[model samples]
Target: MADKEVQNSKKPPSKSVSVVNKTSSVSEDTPKTVPNKGPQVLCLRILNSLNENMKSQKERFEKLESAQYYD
Candidate 1:
């Protein structure tokens, strides 16, 4: 039959199924990555220092402004 002939002309989907199975097994055997937290903690400390510096600078500028207006 023409339908049988068409089916025979196309390659089967079995290879894709085997590929998926292979990837699943490989992923199971692979080790997952552990993230480094040291740098992250250091970065947080640096950001906090920068924020404190900015707050102090803002307070100093406000004091100067008030002093100028009072003179």
Candidate 2:
């Protein structure tokens, strides 16, 4: 039983290594291409909105700081 467990443990790593090698070779042979633009468009929209929000917050903070300095 102990020998069997040791043999079984050793077998899995070799099998996994071969699978990883095959996948890496396949990806290298395939040309990279964008499958869809939907996710990309959504991400850009979210980023733009966040950027606008940050600009507004910065302006508001500056106004508050200037008012406090005047007082």
Candidate 3:
């Protein structure tokens, strides 16, 4: 009886094992909404501000150079 039990335990699961089926409710036509624009907008704003600051700094340096050349 003990040997029979061990043999049964060694056997693989039957072919009739239940398979879990997963179905997605999302369809292809459904438009995916963006999660957040806060970070993206902040990054763009920071880039624009940096560009403007660089332009101003360049203008100031050029003006200083012209003044020194005239002196």
> Best candidate per lDDT, number?
3
Candidate 2 C-alpha lDDT tens digits along 1-71: 89998887876544334344442122233333445688976665566666667778999999999999999
Give the per-residue lDDT digits (tens) of candidate 1, residues 1-71.
99999989896666444334432122323323335678866665566666667778999999999999999
Stretches of candidate 3 off by over 4 Å are 1-36
TM-scores for the candidates: 0.48, 0.49, 0.49
Candidate 3 minimal-lDDT segment of 10 residues:
24-33
User: Candidate 2 — which residues are off by over 4 angstroms?
Assistant: 1-36
Report the C-alpha displacement of residue 48, candidate 2, in angstroms.
0.2
Top-down TM-score ranking? 2, 3, 1
Clash count per candidate: 0, 0, 0
lDDT of 2 at 21: 41
In model 2, pairs of residues that clash are none
Q: What TM-score should be assigned to candidate 2?
A: 0.49
Residue 18 shift from truth in candidate 3, angstroms: 53
TM-score of 1: 0.48
- Global lDDT of model 2: 0.65
